[model samples]
Target chain A: MNTTLQQFNVEKIRTDFPILQQEVHGKPLVYLDNAATSQTPTVVIEALQKYYREYNSNVHRGVHRLSHIATDAYEGAREKVRRFLNASSLQEIIFTKGTTDGINLLASSIGRGLIKPGDEIVISAMEHHSNIVPWQLMCEDRGARLRVIPINDDGEIIFEAYEDLLNERTKLVSIVHTSNSLGTVNPLRQIIDLAHNKNVPVLVDGAQAVPHTAVDLRALDCDFFVFSSHKVFGPTGVGVLYGKKEWLEKLPPYQGGGDMILNVTFAGTKFNELPYKFEAGTPNIADVIGLGVALDYVQQIGYDAISSWENELIQYALKRLQEIEGLRFIGNAKHRAGAISFVLENIHPHDIGTILDREGVAVRTGHHCTQPVMQCFKVPATTRASFAFYNTKEEIDLLIKALYKVIEMFS
Target chain B: MDELRDLYQEVILDHNKNPKNYFQMDEATHSAEGHNPLCGDQVEVFLKVDNERIIDISFQGHGCAISKAASSVMTTMLKGKTITEAKKLFEKYQHLITAEMSEAVDLHEYGHLAVFAGVREFPMRVKCASLSWHTMLQALEEKKEIATTE
Candidate 1:
């Protein structure tokens, strides 16, 4: 490892993860399942344990000191998220259950109000089900067309084809910033610009992107960005949706409940302002604070360094898996993140995954919840081994060694 | 070899590589397809039955070693058996793999399938191993309902 990347310290970083020090089937665990959800750091877990131990109270309505402290921590997380994504204001950041709930909130609120009959909502074929299902449901409800941007053989969105799909009827263009299955980092800056020229808003699903790369919402100029905290090495049940203040104010409230309301007389009630208006009922308070710690953890290590290190891991993994005969990688995108997907001839992905698991190397097998991308690649599924910054080249070598055993067994 | 001995025995791998009764019967009376989307296991079971007796049975699909081997072993045992007898075999095989009736299963008849009897220990793979059996049941139902309808 380079001295710059070693500032994060792989051994020290692994120490923070208690699960990493353990064994699976009498062998040391080699976890490569970051694309699903990353292993949480000690600071994130301690933050959650500390919150429940003390200052455990519902936020936003208390006058006591504990309640006040809890409220500050909860809202402080929103501010951290706002800064992390480089959003214009704190009001633009709304807490959600996860990326799925965030996209659904946008689809129901903004999508219902803006998308009309004969309008078009564009999405890429490489999107997760969370990104695809919401827009699909919205389009089916409204008499709108769900246009898909075709992906190239490498699984990146075809930019020219996406630009051609944008027209006067295009109301929204939602896409994944990085494909979960393929690890293709899409050209969001250009995609957002083209949609803006057509006067259409765009939503970038940053669930996979946020973990490996840094995002600046202002520079990207997209209307909305959504990501889950768990994928970013934080606790689950906490996520953030960053939207422009102007766009958020124009849209309807997401869910109607106690916190979202100002006055309820059963006839007509006034709604709360921007961020709170979107957040209904009680939110995942402890996890939200843990998300702040997770962001602070990444900031301390530096995302720029983390990105380069993960890219190196991806490259090393690709090269190692390539050396195994009859083992072909599925997604070979040039501008990819930290996912390595492949298939072995005469060996099913599940079998490969199982055999690898016995050797203490874990990898995800099958469609990876992106069925359309699987269809685009014309393979039923691929075994994916995704990496985090803490991952080492030695781990990739172990993966290759185990994969060779799998290939030989089938041969 | 000892490391892979417990999971992929020689008999199991042999059956997987050169699967017995593995072909497509074009003039099959019963055919059904089954898929496990979670693992991307797909199996199409084709059976040729004549007067309530299975004259031939084969499978054509892609899957894990356990699934491929399990289906091949089931086909070898079920060929030339009556539909009712095959249904009984299906039940016995299900019980054998699920560890419901382990001691009762005869190893001589089951052959390589005896290796799959250990599969019940691995719960997650039980679905992959049971996929072809599910397709067989589906084919049996299709034969019953469609045959009556015709």
Candidate 2:
């Protein structure tokens, strides 16, 4: 742990995000829904504006000056992503619509090629629907089986049970790196090692992890990783699918269109190399550029600083919220990140969310696309308050204050 | 802020706390489940219709204050009303909540159900307040499919 990085100046950091300055319902906005999507910084917003205002042109096609600039910027964003994830090569990073699109691409392409009838795909119980549904569709298509690795009461995956699920028949393992609703920081290093031991590939959904922690693909050695840009303070409609080069080469092309083809013919067409083969059609150019800048922004602030600040905030929040009568935390994983989910006694999360909104605090109220986890916890839904570096202890105080009001209103 | 007050009025809150006719009707002639997937609000409405009249109505499920209260109020207003009369009331209640009517409608016409007229102010929660009523419609029509506030 870097002590210097731990000294995060949150007040100053909040200045970069212009939207954080606004008020809601006559009170200053207290945005606690970072898990859904983070607030965009001015630099990222400016990057988007600059792309459209200046040399806006279709990438990879023209020899003209504007096209050259656009193509360079677009490709440059890929390089930025490669460095951000510490991937060995640019071919490993594929731009996607978001985490869902990335997972779908991997499932449709790699899954279609590898999965056979009776073959099993192992996923943890805490996976979001985005990760689960695509695999389910792939399994349905190929007559494959979907096996779930159950979690402990604290929402952390039982490592021994996960190991028990892995065998020669297990074709692939997909897991969430950090749970969006529960905030569990899974043991990905150990998980990857276990899967690798069984000669099985793993695809880690890092949508909720990327914003709070530093992810080094080389260190984790996951076969594939996916995350959304919007969740990391970038523009929406763009994400990354980081795949090891060997696996990407083996997978079939996700979609067929221009730029994805090397040679087109009346009878048969040849596909392009690694990343481009998966990224079919014209992509979200401006948002990709914005994502690159957002990565740079996070890098400058440093993940250590962000993680340290957020850890303190969560601890403080948990303590304060525990003081409230009958409030129960849904996930109490020893290792957690980004979000905190809880249910107030005899009060629905929706009611609490509505009251919190009136107090100008935004929180996500529901199963959070992890209905399986909700079922595991035996709750209809949980109220989640996810944090970013820009969020403060003051905001947590406001949330606690508003929660008291919810109790009063319901009582 | 007044909109918030109207949305969570005392009447609505009371209904949510101690909902009336909130039991599964085992001998119901018609029944349907309503689900608001976005919020995980689920409601099951049961109706016992006799000679074009609603002899008994009850609901069972879990949801927010707005949804639970709406279901409670709906069961109270639906009992003893003719099928045609229930349909008309449903239409009028829908009109009041959606605020689609050009002319202002009298709250007295809706009686206790008028408490939900304040829901018109909250566009997002309109679904919450209407989930049970929509399920009630499905139950009355004897639709075998589940109703959703999508």
Candidate 3:
């Protein structure tokens, strides 16, 4: 509808996603829930199909042909993830179920190795439940205290509060990269640097970041980073945890199972080296390969193009949504990405979500798994319409129209 | 759009906009909280009973329009009804809301409650509509735990 859409060639990108082509209810589907999980592109879907159709076997176990082929593709995905994050080595990349599984892995390994009684682990108020709960459980296990860094009214983490939270007793700092509820992109380099100064290892929940922005783990200097495959246009049940080699070696194995061992006996078991030591069982093979194809898919499109298009869409959405009477934005961070959450006066988010769905506009309406952030904003929930590269400016207009309909109905 | 209107009819909308008995009952004899954790909607049902009959019923909480309206109409229906009658009406209302859409809803039978008959089409909102009734049941039973319409 405007200049940015013309340059991005979103029509071409939309065609790559088959789900976006269909209609919901009676209208064209306007999928704006990219923060939950991006729609899988045809390339990723066909890659999944080809793997099962051709080379479907367990990885690094059998010496047969199909097994070898599957192993190569699986390991090749690790290499792709390693390069995608610009990690130092393939041994530093570990595959897990998703971001939740990755955090649970770290909580277990680090809880046993590093945390002691009376120690403190710091997380921000905007963290999703996945980031918050694991640390709480781990802290309970190790007799450590969970300290929360408060965010300002705009959903930006109070940097001073974060600084005050880190001290001699602070063992680890875990924080979100881009808030799923608030759309605020936290300053990671600054956050990580501040933690490192206090000898605290920082683990970043990059679940909302990697798809919308470039992440060079080496450049950011974060000790650990995690994101989901589905959020990055890959298959579900697959995710990557990028850890530094030195840290991965020090942390204990997360689980005990097949393929994560160099040698095992009834009397004793010697855990495998760096990454596989953490990856304990039959990993998600097809989806991992799908994740590689997804990485290739994004790299081909380029993050610059994706960010610019989504930026335009978000700006347009913010401007148009403001046109509706009694509409209020929940988060107004100076730096935001891909998502915009708002509330209509005297109308619940669920009602807005229902009306929007009737118009075939899919937006997430809830606390977005960040209840603390909701408390910070002093609302029960907000209607969130997150974007992807394939979303057009016209879709934002549809959302605006649906929102106006919500106002009419409620009035 | 017709389907949306079916779900949010004028009756429901009016009840939502000007909810009845929307207050905290400090002198209530029995009260229970209902929570829909998925959407963060909550309601507290309060009752004043005299000789097994509800003399007064009111509700206070935060939730969607369906929930607020449903709660308001529920309070109006339950006032001056016996405990047994309240339970019977709850069963009938629950059956109506959870009933199959293919079989037409008997609008005359439910009266005020029929406004919520459209909720069954939207499966996710059914819980929002049902939360108050369950919380009222918890209040009647004198249960300490919060009721959840998950």
Every model's DockQ: 0.56, 0.79, 0.94
- Over B27-106, each residue of candidate 1 has an lDDT whose tens digit, in order, gives 99899888886766788889999999999999988878888888888898888989898888778677766774335656
Cα lDDT of model 3 overall? 0.92
Better of 1 and 3 by lDDT: 3
Tens-digit per-residue lDDT, A195-263, candidate 1: 998888989999998888889888999999999999999999999998899999999998999799888
Location of the lowest summed lDDT over 10 successive residues in candidate 1 chain A: A1-10
Best by DockQ: 3
- True interface contacts retained by model 2: 0.81
Question: What TM value does model 3 have?
Answer: 0.98
Error of 2 at A363 (Å): 0.4
Per-model TM-score (chain A alone): 0.98, 0.98, 0.99
**lDDT per residue as tens, model 2, A277-394:** 8888988999999999999999999987787888989998999999998989999999999999999888889989888998999999999999999999999999999999899889
Instruction: Summarize candidate 3's per-residue lDDT along A1-411 as a digit string, tens digits.
Output: 567666789889889999999999989999999999999999999999999999999988899999999999999999999989999899999999999999999999999998899999999999999999999999999999999999888889999989988899998899999999889999988999999998899999999998899998889999999999999999999998888899989888889988789998999999888788988888899999999999999999999888887887788888898888788888899999978999889999999999999999999999999988888888999999999888888899888888888888888
CAPRI band of model 1?
Answer: medium
- Interface RMSD for each of the candidates: 1.9, 1.1, 0.4
RMSD each, Å: 3.2, 1.8, 1.1
